[model samples]
Target chain A: MDSQSIATTPEELDRSVLPHAHEHPAFLRHHFEDVGQQREAASFGMWVFLLTEVMFFGGLFCAYLIFRNWYHPAFVAGSNTLDITLGTTNTAVLICSSFTMAMAVYSAEIRRRGQLILFLVLTIVLGSAFLGIKAVEYHQKYVDHHIPGLDFSIQEFVHPSNPKAIPLAPDMAEKTQLYFFLYFAMTGMHALHMIIGIALLFIMVARASKGAYTEGHVIPVENFGLYWHFVDIVWIFLFPLLYLISRYR
Target chain B: MTEKTQETHQDAEVHVVKPPVYLAIFLALLALTALTTGISFIDLGVFNAVIALAIACFKASLVVLFFMHLHYSSRLLKLTVAAGIFTFLLLISLTMTDYISRAWGMF
Candidate 1:
């Protein structure tokens, strides 16, 4: 929690704003009343940031909804091309990671240093496994010529290799590019957030190894838990919206 | 229950969520994921997408309430989250309404 104490210049932090002066820990910032107030304020700020993230991704979702409704067959064909096995596995992996992250926050609260380190490591591994599977899917898409730049082609949807898949007319197949575009845009944005989160996890690991958060200071762990769960929540929506599009006949 | 609530009232800083709570939420999420996937395999016409979205919303709520610990948080934080969702709905409804009402009378 106090790892960021170095982030702000000392002179700028007004100790007066934090009124609970009776036996406070060093990690409790001078600008907060107590650890409770500090934790609440930090979480409130985190939720605000998450709210911004909502609207940010909302634009992409809005586009997906309109385009999907407009081109139902193209959407269906395009969705069927997705590897359900990998998508389901990734969903399970992310859910498991969210579980581990919640445990990590619990470990931090209880001041269990070893469990904290272990859970954080597990989260990093599970998160990385998700990215590895996602990378495999992206590479497969690239090989299938589904990347939506000028190199993009609709042969897959136009003449699907899978007999079970609905075939799209060439023009409608071109519309499949729109579907793929939204797919990459949405999932790619999600992967970018995962990459950033993994990077942060590494930093947290290094700091936690040094007993940074095990000393009755859990704001950082708690706040980061909020963030990790938020990423999972986004995937919770994405799994159905992207992967399960009228998948039946 | 009264004693537990009183303890929390005094020590508001550290709220330790039991591991069982987390485990239960995790299982619920996994079960919902399975349900959504299984349901998608049936052709329910227009109901399919609606049901899928509804399930997704339910799973997201679990994550928000338990995993994110918003249930234990303050009212202002809850309102903030609600406002975000409201604005998102506003965006979706307004856009969908425009598109849906575009060529109204001809039908």
Candidate 2:
């Protein structure tokens, strides 16, 4: 190595150093005038990405609302079959993940590499926990034959395990299949987002290990934090709408 | 370069005190989440939807203001985001209008 290319101390690599400097090729973008501009543009771009996601999920929500109103009785019965405990737990887990993701961004800002990594890992773990619980719930639905395909069985609703249980008419029970279809579609989409977020967290962890964000360019971490929180927010809406409505009935 | 030009350029990159406010907004978000969930168990009839949506809007506002840093951003960026959401809302509302009005015809 040339003497002019000596390694600089961490303290010497402060925020005043232009983030657009050629130290990291991956961090620079041709369209951006500087690192700040690059970061701002990237964050704005992410918001636009999230807007599209909202619209994507928004379609499912519209379908759900329509079917829900058209067959209110069946929708209520369908909601009652969901295990509220599991759904509520998943909601809490997702919120905790959002909290940790926010802390990860804050740690990056404060230049605490260890804390940033810790929170990022915590966020990933919490997210996985949510998906795990959701899997179990889905499995239970499968065993009960509530899955919304042609294989779905209406026996559970017509022949209630408890004599006092609400006996849905065959037509209403069939409409329940529509409710389950929307449920799986919406929650499945949300879970897909969680998986993608976890994958990105892995990439962020690798970059963070190289002190990318710790060097004061924390905007990547921050922008990713926003995306994670937006995903969490979508689930927050989904949980109540899909799993909690008329659950006590 | 003229002194006025230099001053204006310097002001462009001014580092505002945004971090603390962002943290406070984060705390507000946590509180709002808890509040919304707690209220959901109550029998609010049709008002539950209104309340839930209201709280969600409040939470979304906090995220947009603090985490997304819209409060510190330029007017152009703000308009860009607003336009996107407005367009989305328009789509949702118009589509729902068609579906919701169909209910009366079915009766």
Candidate 3:
């Protein structure tokens, strides 16, 4: 390690010493060795943050698993009340949004400014649509008095309207509240993430329209795509666990 | 690694996933979603939940691998994701051991 051999100052560093100096775009941070290092560091940091998110959501999943096993019948009844059509529709909507987000990232990478903006806007619209459908589902729950701690009633569970449905004892019927509680907690958290993702999408679209991400600075767009996809992945698990698992049972 | 080598490596690593690939993955995910929903209505007994989760896992893998570009990502990022999932499984399994061994069906 010859200290004197390396250029000690920014001005001293030039194409003569660093042959690839011209490739260092202005957006590259000074502390990073190059664009690649900067991109990797940023991606690594984002993933670490997402890992913490995994743990956060994992706790909720663990609780749901234990309780669902303990009160299997209550869970089945509670889950059956959910509108499967809406649930499936929302899942498809979110999957489409993820597809649009991937296209947005691709557009940014290829430096197609118009396409980038278009896809970002599309993602935002689809995300909002997802939230709109979720609102309808929550409203249905409200109308049925299924919101835990608000105005919950177990009459439907106690004497189910479906002829083939198995009725629950009053005590078991009360356990349905726990199922609804987990449902609201998990889906509410997921919805909050979608709301945040949509809000960020607006900002990304604004910046993308200004040629921000298309000019060889695509890290922001790429990282946000990761986030949007992560949210979609959460829904992938969420759909089956909350809506699909107990349907046939 | 020299600056010149890093520049060349960066250029090599920037593999732009095409629109067709994204579309293919998207369609596959939607199909899997529909399949899982469909299967949930059939009373497969214990396997109903199992199949639903299996399909969900497959759907998530597609998003992660292609859409999220984990397939093209560096090993460091790949291991980071795997580690996160490993820890999550550990948490669930460890807790279950305690719960399952104690009171059995008492809950």
User: Among these predicted structures, which one has the highest DockQ?
Assistant: 3
Q: Please give, for residues B15-91, the per-residue lDDT of candidate 2 as tens digits.
A: 43334665676567667767776776787887776787787777777766665557667565688778887987898
The predictions' CA RMSDs to the true structure, in order, are 5.0, 5.2, 5.8
User: Where is model 2 chain A poorest over a 10-residue stretch in terms of lDDT?
Assistant: A1-10
Alpha-carbon local distance difference test for all models: 0.84, 0.74, 0.86
> Alpha-carbon error at B42 in model 1, in Å?
1.3
Please state the CAPRI-style docking class of candidate 1: acceptable
Candidate 1: regions farther than 4 A off: A1-3, A6-22, B1-13, B103-107
Residues A16-65 of candidate 1 have per-residue lDDT tens digits of 23556464566667777556667777888899999899988888998888
Interface RMSD of every predicted model, in angstroms: 3.9, 3.5, 1.9
Better of 2 and 3 by DockQ: 3
Q: Spell out the clash pairs found in candidate 1.
A: none
Give the DockQ of candidate 2: 0.32
lDDT of candidate 2 vs native? 0.74
The predicted structure with the larger TM-score, 1 or 3, is: 3
* Residue-wise C-alpha lDDT for candidate 1, range B1-107, written one tens digit per residue: 26664555354444688899999999999998889888888889889899999999999999999989888877777898999899889988998888778845421
TM-score of chain A of 2: 0.87
- What digit string (tens of lDDT, one per residue) describes model 2 on residues A7-71? 12444454334465444334444555455555656666777888888889888887888788888
